[model samples]
Target: MVAIRIEFDDDEQYERLKKLKKHRGLTWKGLLLEGEKRVLEQTPE
Candidate 1:
């Protein structure tokens, strides 16, 4: 298992992510894992 640390240096970026988190009804971990899945799906192996 791997752990990731997310640091937002921009206020807008952090707020946007928080808003999306609420809109999608996800906790911090869920938000990150879901985002990871999205990127993985778009990436070519």
Candidate 2:
């Protein structure tokens, strides 16, 4: 698996993601992967 890094300018947004990850019982990677998959599935081919 490939590793990636991202930065957030908004602390509130980062905090929200952290909360969501905990709420979903997922690691940061899992939450990002799930979000990526959902976005990809919704995008036009």
Candidate 3:
């Protein structure tokens, strides 16, 4: 129910993420959500 915009510092940063997305065979949403899951799991509330 919300829209989020992601900004990369440079092309290299974006390219690095693109590579991970390709290697994981994940859509952009899946990749971002996976990262969010990891952060939540590692951090205490």
Pick the TM-score winner: 3
User: After aligning candidate 3 to the native by TM-score, how far in Å is the CA of 4 from where it should be?
Assistant: 3.5
Clash count for candidate 2 is: 0
**Candidate 2, which segments miss by more than 4 Å at Cα?**
1-3
lDDT values of the candidates? 0.94, 0.93, 0.97
Task: Give me candidate 1's TM-score against the actual structure.
Answer: 0.76
Error of 1 at 4 (Å): 5.6
Per-residue lDDT over 1-45 for candidate 3, one digit per residue giving the tens place of the 0 to 100 score: 988899999999999999999999998999999999999999999
Candidate 1, overall lDDT? Answer: 0.94
Q: What's the number of clashes in each of the models?
A: 0, 0, 0
Best by lDDT: 3
Provide the lDDT at 27 for model 2: 98
Name every residue pair that clashes in candidate 3. none
Query: What is candidate 2's lDDT per residue for 1-45, written digit by digit as tens?
Result: 987888988999999999999999999889988999999999999
Misplaced by over 4 Å in model 1 are 1-5
Per-residue error (Å), model 1, residue 19: 0.2
Candidate 2, which ten residues in sequence have the lowest lDDT sum? 1-10
> For residues 1-45, could you state the per-residue lDDT of candidate 1 as single tens digits?
987788998999999999999999999999988989999999999
